[model samples]
Target chain A: MTHRTIKPAPNIVQGTPLDAKALKRGKIFLNSYAPALRYTWDTGEAMGRYLAELKNGRLIARSCRKCERVMIPPRMFCERCFRPTDDWVYVKATGTVNTFSLCYVSWDVRRLKQPEIPAVIEIDGASPGMGILHLVRKVAPKDVRIGMRVAAVWKPPAQRTGSITDIAYWMPINRRSQRTVSAK
Target chain B: MNERVAIIGVGVMAARPSSEHLSFKEMMFEAAQKAYADAGIDAHEVESFVTCAEDLTEGISIFDEYTPDQLGAVQKPMHTLTQDGLYGIADAVMQLRSGLVGLVVVEAHSKHSNLENPNSILNYALDPVYNRPLDFNPHVIAGLEMNGFLHATGITQAQCAQVVAKNRTHALKNIAAAYPMNLRAEDVQSSPYLCYPLRDAEMAKSADGCVVVVLAGASRAQPSKSRPVWIRGVGFTNDSPTLESRDWIDAQYIRAAAAMAYGQAGIKDPVAEIDLFEVDDAYAYKELQHLVALGIYPQAVAAGRAVENGESGAAGKMPVNVSGGSLGIGHTLEASGLYRLAEIVCQLRGEAGPRQLPRAKVGLAQSWRGVPTTSGAVVILGR
Candidate 1:
């Protein structure tokens, strides 16, 4: 189990970065491509209903009869119980923040003027720790904390578009309410 | 296991930042060509092929339909693994053990530089209805996970920054490393944040590369004059998909995968039996998390100390990522596993040049599919 005289070759190389301008100007010998890949995924039995509920300024989840757990951002099946969802339940609009980040980068990898506070909020009616990723706005990044109680602030019914954005953002549940109860 | 599987040959071609000379298909062909030559066999001799890729990364759906021709496996038994490079190699090892094939090829690569919107590509990987709509950089999850990891384990952010400093310093010896720098801990600690706890310097830069490994059964893989490296054990696992339900601090999937691989390898204590590691460090914090999961450290807090103490460096107790790893070497996405494996093979074969470990007998290669998922694979190699 030894290399008596094994030789090695370089695995990495320094290459000039491709210049798109050169390619566009016909100075480079390469082809250019732009992907227009698009798709409209079926929201399915659970999410279809979830989005519909969001448009009406309400939060919804599916109840798994087998496990007796409510999962938010609802799904058609109970992943743990391995069965189809048995019932639909409307969960509380407020949830506790499980984790959060002050993101200074945008979706396009650009720096942002204002850092976005994104957190995973576990809804009330959903099982404990059943959280969904969402933005928590109106609270200073330094003030956001794990286990903070936040409630969904929805857009006016006229502006609802059957999308997650229908809810403007999650706002910390009030200073007085935060001290009285733990995350449901 | 009735038979053994060995990596007979390895090939890697990396272009930092981008590859202007070759097309994606041509890149795959070039790496495959070198692997076939290294294996001392023609492309036709390789019975089956397993290619690693992701639809989102390639910006093409059904990438498999376009794979066979370049690898010279047209009309043969070729399948695809939508996983990291290490997972594909693990699958090839199983294929060899099944007795259905004497030889197999595992291929993976990252052509990320070609994507006009890599961040958007990553966003598509999130849970569509709930996660994708957040519209922030998909990397934000690393921050969340890092925050959780540090909070639960008491591993300080400064300690993680030390991981960055050490890895970048080690990368200096690696010609293939994209981020090799003469750096200090404070350099990374004071760097701009990508996600808190994850400084921009600590994050792996995207690099384009292809890796192909030729795997053969023990008998079929005779090393008449060359060295022989065998796959003693291989395993992969995926934890709960719900981010809320998982062990936020530890890499549970890595722990399971390492357990299975170590169990099969008959390894009792990794610190004593294993020679070195090339674990996933797509992010610096991940290196610590996976090490904790792999039993190198009893917990994250201890692992952080080991990192700060230089006990994990090449000259220390157990060397990790001596080939500079993905942090030093640019991360090659799906192909990262094979890149790590290639480094291990080079080390075990005693051909790793300046970074080669002395008297190294066994090595481990770890791979995580990256953020927004809780899946990972591990492979144990012994010579």
Candidate 2:
């Protein structure tokens, strides 16, 4: 049986569009309220250990005996293997950039005077492809590149706290040597 | 497989940047009323109801409580998915195919205009311990992924711009689209960069709208006023939420979701079997990335060339986002997938007045829950 085409009825959609100015000027009746919600997250066993090691100028990862993959921002279990992770592995404070972004806007969409370089650094001694998100600094934003080696810049021991911020930022390493080799 | 499901009715409120005159409930009521009328049935006939929304976005606790009244779903089996509308459709399809519900209704909406700071809300979606401390815009994730994807697949920045040019131009013919325009690849390339490699024009602006769809079992669907758009297959998947473990370059979530849908539909070759597609275009690069993941194009470079050559255009071999996609229609958050599904239904039923495709028998709709997450859903529809 051939069914005839079914068209939507006329004026089916009903909604009035308004601009930000009109909404602010009270051109339309409105009610506004802001909810203040607070949260306190518990950094679990693996993450707690990871953050603690960061304060001491070190990086730690958990290894899965089944997959033999060392993961950062350590988790208690291996998702792929569906088993509890086997051991804690200490990784180097230096690594290569897996990917990077030069952000020109703030979280609220406002343009920034200085672009922030956010990157995923694959830490040394961990399995390949395992990386953590962090900021890249101490170099021009344009100079940051994927696969470039970088070392962690840590805060003073007196100021150190159990947090990811214990390490100030990641900075490019062997820049002079890299430039000389490229020039050769 | 024992019973088939079909979409009997679809109703939508045309997307706009803001809808100050109507509350979310009013928007829901309007959409539901039109859908019921289109199906030639009343709300009471629907045995199950599913609404897609996030509590943070709605600014209300237990958002589903507000849904039942507007949809006339009071005292009915109703729940909310905190995911996109495509997931809601998948849920309804399962219910109908289970032989428990003869009729079902799925609804989703976006009141993004009400948000004073959407970025702040999106920030809460990040991992508190690992990612949230960075204090940067969540879209930087898109920027990072775009960089990785381009480097891995050899797709250029100019090719990404062509996506914006084609999708926006297509929106010019869609009355429901909010940001329709005639743009060139050069225009997008010259636009200010929000994040390096991700220009401001590349991202979709949020819009306010609601979509309500009425679905029924094979027996119940035959009596509807509108021609039934059969749900041949439905699939949804979520990859790792952690930034450390997930694949940054490839959209494995979309790949798995599409694989499940294709398998159920018995589709061997999606490029030839599907007539048209309305996939997610939350960002210009995402359209190309998703095309690669959908297996429609072999890789990002091939997808880019297809866009440049207009092979994905309205008249191309495989028409993609002919309804302007989220880029042109304005991203409707959770309602995005339903909007895409409604457009496909209109085309398959031959009711898409101006932007209709000729001999469109099969179509697909896909959606991704945007940034700071890896979750998506896919649905295939046939006439």
Candidate 3:
């Protein structure tokens, strides 16, 4: 039996002939039956709920039930022990910048966009090794490097909301004693 | 021991830029039917089907929508892999190894001519977080890899052009080949640069076509309708998705894949063991880089001597791209592997009219998924 081939009309109504072949600017129908992918934040819920605490100017982490290892960003499951986590410990908002890349492009291609530097920082008061992916502000793209000490600059208490973006990118925290000592 | 699968038949639809007369399914069925006819097996004879396909967003909705039934795969265990065509072939090899199924059909189609912006469509394959944000044209990744390949291997631009000239020359013998032209180093050099160090002429022209092959277990009674090319071995691998992460100097994925496949095929030296090759030259420079990865081209100014030996033609050392490869036959993405499979099977059967190789016993075909993911596969076919 012969299968009838399906062809759709040209999608791009305007454009110069692409090649010397003199072919019409057209569309082909692709029939895909693969199962669709659906995802839920099964593990991200604790991180989301803990991050919800940040709106009130508080940091929280989950302590592993078996290993007693602290997980930042409060995940529901512990990676090391392979067990569920329940201990919600509050911590301070001080951490060091782990690594970062200065991005100069935007998702939208139409407009000329400014440089945006997205960085991954390890939050203070959370587990020493735990890290979060966010942005860094008030620093030259070139000046950004690994191990740069930065502190979270939260919004006013009443204005605080449970979100990473609420911190408005970490700022360089200057140590006066270290600066003066280095000067001597 | 599980039964070894043998490709009992192979067929390819004539590749073209735009098949105004045929739909993608029609084109696929054309090749599938021809393969069934060649194998003397009806669609009902096959136990399952595997097709290589991408999202409908590339064309219209229902991507695997028109396959199966159209390819005569109705009511069987059919599955479509959203991967490169050759990977789908690798999947078939796995299915046959399980011993649950004896016969399987693998089909891949390319209707590139349908896309408005092929580059934009290609960008979707990149890491959404980093590479895609920069909106890197997929060719740039190849361009970067080619630069590293040339610098590390010392294969010169001229050698790259020679690869093109030889492949196109061999393609001239392929009736189904769409871009069979007698090219010269100067001709390729003069073509505009799509990306630095890569010329427009060097790139494989995208086309619309279908290629399908019918493979059955070796333990099954021989059909005798057509000679079978046993699947000696199959190898496929994917490299780091981030271009920044890998040592671009070598196509580690291709080398690793080749080793696994060559080992399984009991081939210690591909240059000596493989009688002919069907290299996936999506871009002319890719042939040089991939040859190096396959451990064939070892220098900057590679003695593309093997390519120019006239062996890849009708009679001439280890003919490569005798069906013209993607360079001459046009790269149909998913269908390209089947095209390579068809040529190898035909050559081994002494059925490649005018393009047949002399005393060809073994065939090797290698393909790389274009970019973002430096993924590739290598397969060795034996009679």
Stretch of 10 with least lDDT, candidate 2 chain A: A175-184
What fraction of the true interface does each of the listed models get right, in terms of native contacts kept? 0.00, 0.00, 0.00
Question: On lDDT, who's better, 1 or 3?
Answer: 1
Q: Which window of 10 residues has the lowest lDDT sum in candidate 3 chain B?
A: B300-309
TM-score of chain A of 1: 0.81
Distance from true location, Cα of A87 in model 3, Å: 73
Evaluated at residue A101, the lDDT of candidate 1 is: 95
| Local error of candidate 3 at residue A71 (angstroms) | 62
- Candidate 1 chain B: minimum summed lDDT over ten consecutive residues — where? B14-23
In candidate 3, what are the lDDT values of residues B1-383, reduced to their tens digit? 36787888777888887775555655666787788888878777788888888863345445665576566666678888887777878888888888889888888887777666667667667666556667556788777877777777666777777777877777898888888998887888888888878778888888778888888888763847557788888999987767667877777888899988988888878878888878778888777667767876545344455555554444666567778888889888878777887888888888888877776899888888776667889988988
lDDT of each: 0.83, 0.87, 0.74
Q: What are the root-mean-square deviations of the candidates from the true structure over C-alphas?
A: 25.5, 26.4, 24.1
For each candidate in turn, the TM-score is 0.67, 0.68, 0.65
Ranking by lDDT: 2, 1, 3
The TM-score each candidate achieves on chain A is 0.81, 0.80, 0.66
